[model samples]
Target chain A: MQIEAISKANSPEIACVVLCCRIFIKTASAEELEQFVQAHEMDWDEVYKYAAFHRVRPILYKVLDNCKIPAPVLGRFRNYCRALSVFAFERQVESARIQQVLGQQGIVVRMYKGLDFTKLVYGGDIGMREFTDMDMMIDSRQLPELAKVMTAEGYECSQIEYLRRFPEHYVANKKDICFYKRSPMGKLFGFEFHHRPGNFLMDQSIGFRELLGQDYLHHSAPFSQEQYYRLMLLNHGASDYFPNLRSLVDMALLSQKGIGSVPEQLRRVERLSQELSMRLLDGPAAATPADNVVMRCATRITKLQLTVTLRSVWERRYMHIRFSASFSDTFRMAMKFLHYLMLPNELDINGVQLFSFKLYYLAKMVRCVNFPGRFKKVFSRV
Target chain B: MTQHDIVHRNEKQFMISNLGNEIVLMDIQQGHYINVNPVGSVIWNKLAVPIMVKDLIHSLVEEYGVSTAQCEDDTLKFLQKLQQHHMLNVQ
Candidate 1:
């Protein structure tokens, strides 16, 4: 029903676009959309929003047809379009500072996610979503040294504990490491260090070492401007651990440009889809006794939907509970919990798996209920 | 488990932060100080609006496996903290 009736529609391309729109609509308003379109040098029309909102399936299909966007790069295009507004204000300043840093350090750091993804994945002439933070990923090994250098240059590390305790663990085992600094403007900006080439979905073996060892693509010093641009989007999109459609769109846009290995990258991510799809359809065994009912009922939604739905549910379930200083801060924590829950599990893992997931979920629910503030006394003593 | 009597008179919004594990009152003006301790932050983030103190205590009891008596005591203490901080305004 969501599919458009275009005769030559690229199934993957169209689906990704539709997905991006859904996410974009959730956080953005009609006025914002217009402003974003104008900032991007695109024609801003009220009708476009209606088409995007009402019959997004067909409208996206038509846009793809007219643009002749490649099936693999649809994700990247959406990100580009969404970032237009913010880019106008921050692009030059941010990129110049990053470029200056890279040049001075003799290191090549690529921009990813927002506008960079648009340039790499989409048509290189798109807008992007209005997200507050900047995500950049550097070589995993270079992170510690880079962090030190940056600290010397006035970038104070926000997560001192993570830097102290998790650098080796993340470099040697886990995914990217998240580090941030409060900008002079008080905005929180993030940087991620990546040892691996692919994200969580891809086999960890495809790390920077392996990819460089195999000499997959041209790996040169002082990378070309195009390479720098594409690398940023690739890194940004990959680090989005959640099945956020906007992230997918960012990557898809890159694929269209024939930049990076979009097809191979997406194929690897398909594993996430296949695993979740199977779990939802076949009714994978419950991890906990209480979770059985929840899982069975949850199967009604697709496995991909599970992550986003659970995330939204968790947010609504715990909106009033103060986890930190602000609702925004608390929501961020809830999203983290949701991300943790999205971890893939082995099929034969038994009820222990179900139990843990449900346990966490229920625990979160319990926190929402405010049970006579029983835990407060214990908390006070500590 | 100690029952912390949480009163939400004139309550508007609430939030829980992860850094210090504190429950913050979002409704209060410039000097909003509905704060909690680490353990309190864990429970504070879970309090949905329109939540009852009893149901909250019951859920905590099941999840943490705490005794009913502890739940009652804890709840009361937490509520007192909220009142002290001017987080909860009695009708």
Candidate 2:
């Protein structure tokens, strides 16, 4: 009659890992707790890594508190949670301070994504989730003034490094770019100044320009709660090959009454895979993926699974109808997508610009050969 | 409505979280925070369950070895501040 034990045995290591984490912070008896640990074989470290990586260490703390886990691990997790909570509070205070200044200047700032999503999903407990950056949407014309304001506050555009390296990056991408400032404590805070720009990977961005004249500036967030959750479900798998587990967890929690989160993620991935398969028929277009291996894997699977049949006919109609764009637009996006891979961006040496196509391709080659460096830099930064 | 009325009232309107040494009381509807110091932190922990002002003061005085008069005075002041911040309500 042990549901936990049954679930653990029936599910895979990954599913059980997510399942235990999904239920760990919630009410659980000793038997449930035993199965939670027993289900995790060579997965404790992996779960911890994902928890920390996704900034859900605070969530992990609550789960581990009821266990007979080692003291050192528990203590470190507690400390991490405490530090994260403090940092989140400071950032919230900072946001309030900035909001005041911007308000006085009559600049309507629409906060969204990162922390806004956290507040809606986790109820403003900063420790409950981790947000390394903030997302604020302003009117497109307000960019210069925001740049001035951030610069006055000793903050530089976070995209400055990327833009410097790839001069066309500004034109190639959407959104107003992000501003950066290092706190006195050495934490880098990024404020993404998004205006939507109608250039998301799926090209289904909310009408940024249309909402400009409205008073959504005073809105709680960029999108309503329903829209926010839906966007997370949609965007998580659109151009990205893999769905983020934590985002999936958030979606699940947000829509618990609906489809279960992990199953929802698998469905989204399946949907997006179809979209990518359509793009493969057209060109090597869409958002950037890491390497040729990913590109080949996706293309090979879709090619075999696809035929000039009823299902393929429906998929072709579905994808094209979903995205309204011309062939030229697709061609431009294809080049831009490749350029994103080739250019010296966050994934490359900072301040290094390779403007020419040849130089860009060379950098791309080097990046593929030195893939471990990418993971190293990310871990180091975190 | 007044400091006397808030003295023993329980918190029901606001949501709260304990971050180890500190506690954060939030008014989700208004998006405001009532932050407190370590001494005020103890008061927050005590307020988790209902207790009279006199009882809270007595416990604090015993735990900190302070005089009853001083404990009562400080507790009243903290309670008054909580009332001003709209964190307290009628039990």
Candidate 3:
């Protein structure tokens, strides 16, 4: 009853929309805010509420409403908004440039969460998410050449010597660049070029290499673009969106617009979600020995078997979800329960403590029974 | 706050730091202040309440090891500047 009361009060979907609006308006520049004013009609009261909560959201809302607004002074009040707008505009510009660079290098550099993330996820009615850097992953072998091209184009490569001396553990996962500026203002608007996503193990598992470039169901669906775009959306959402309701909203939007079975897409998304949760919660060293068990279990679970899992993940109140230690923790628990509800087994693996491999094997057996031909083989080799 | 009674601590004020390499003043509340460095930020937390001239000078000396005499003078000057800008008061 308590859970029901809380759930009825705060809708995750509404929160997602409001958060998107907050991010969008908080980041728009005078020029951009002016564009917003001309381009769309907004509920000023709601925009004001968002601005109150998130510092930059209102400025962005204003900018979108009136692009002609003079740039606010770089004081404390306007700093956040200014920073956000600068970050948004820079990401868009850099993503375009990175796309061109990748094109020249014969790389099919798929853009995930660039302009579309802001436009579609934020409901196009408000400003979109603002990020300080643009993330674009390329073929690992292309790292050297990509670095060279970036350097030639005025972006400086991250100095290994400094990293070694400083030894920041966070930097190890993502390869990046400062791209020093030439002008005074340009100096404020420096850029970051990211080669990797987050953690090393994560990079290895979901990296471009791990990505089953092999086509999925989205291939048959009719769209202006080909299979790669759909995969990009799935990968991005699977990698980043699960913990936050906002991301799920984006996924929902994509599911609505794109011609496909929403439930089926969600089912596949559920699988990816499980895998992501396992990877994030189980550290690399801890997960190494248990990889087989986890993989085996993951392969076994069916969508229908995960009814309780979905109920738990989608059913919770905001306070419970928001205050949960981290996003990964919440998803992992929900997924593990889903795994058990399907087919139970005692799975074994060194780092895979959450679900026993035996349980996974049982789920796999159920899947094998349903889709005899497609169940294929165990992934113990990898 | 009298200019003579004022004292400034130059060790590092989170309230005024760098923005793209240029130092800029930040809004100050009761306790929190953030100094934006080139790389990112250095946030100073849990500032002593009712910050006094002598206390700030002592803090600067203990934190940065500046001479007490110079610390007091500098702190005074900085406090005056903050007072002018309505950031701090003698209440």
- Candidates in order: C-alpha RMSD to true structure: 25.7, 11.6, 20.9
Candidate 3 local distance difference test against the native = 0.39
The local lDDT score (0 to 100) that residue A90 gets in candidate 2 is 58
CA lDDT of B53 in candidate 1?
Answer: 73
Candidate 3 chain A lDDT trough over 10 residues, lowest sum: A300-309
Candidates in order have lDDT scores of 0.41, 0.55, 0.39
Better of 1 and 3 by lDDT: 1
Stretches > 4 Å off in candidate 3: A1-91, A94-110, A119-127, A157-198, A203-238, A241-245, A258-382, B1-91
The local lDDT score (0 to 100) that residue A255 gets in candidate 2 is 53
Candidate 2 pairs with clashing backbones: none
Ranking by DockQ: 2, 3, 1
Error of 3 at A288 (Å): 30
Docking level of model 2: incorrect
For this target, which candidate reaches the highest lDDT against the unseen true structure?
2
| Candidate 2: segments with Cα more than 4 A from true spot | A1-17, A24-30, A38-47, A158-172, A197-200, A204-215, A218-223, A239-243, A257-336, A339-382, B1-5, B8-51, B54-91
lDDT of 3 by residue, A1-382 (tens): 1212212444322222233333332321244333434444444444434344333342333333323322332233245544454445444555666678767876544444444445444443222343334444444445455555656776653443333332242244334534544432363334444444432212233433223243321233322222333444444433333433233334344433443322333234444433533332121122123334334433332121111123243333221223223468557545544543453222222112323334445554544464654533533321
DockQ of each: 0.01, 0.15, 0.02
Across A1-382, the per-residue lDDT of candidate 1 in tens digits comes to 2223210232333333343353333322334333333333322232234233322322243243334334443434343332333232344345547657765886656544444443333333223233444545466667666766666656555433344444554454345555566655465555554445554432343454333333322244433344432343334322323233333333333332444432354332333322322232221232223223223322322333322334354443332122123467457656654654443222112212233333434444433453798655643443
Q: What does the lDDT read for residue A141 in candidate 2?
A: 57
- For model 1 the local lDDT of residue A54 reads 29
Tens digit of per-residue lDDT, candidate 2, span B1-91: 3333425434566555555445665565565666566688888778767676767787899999999888878888888788777765545
Ranking by TM-score: 2, 1, 3
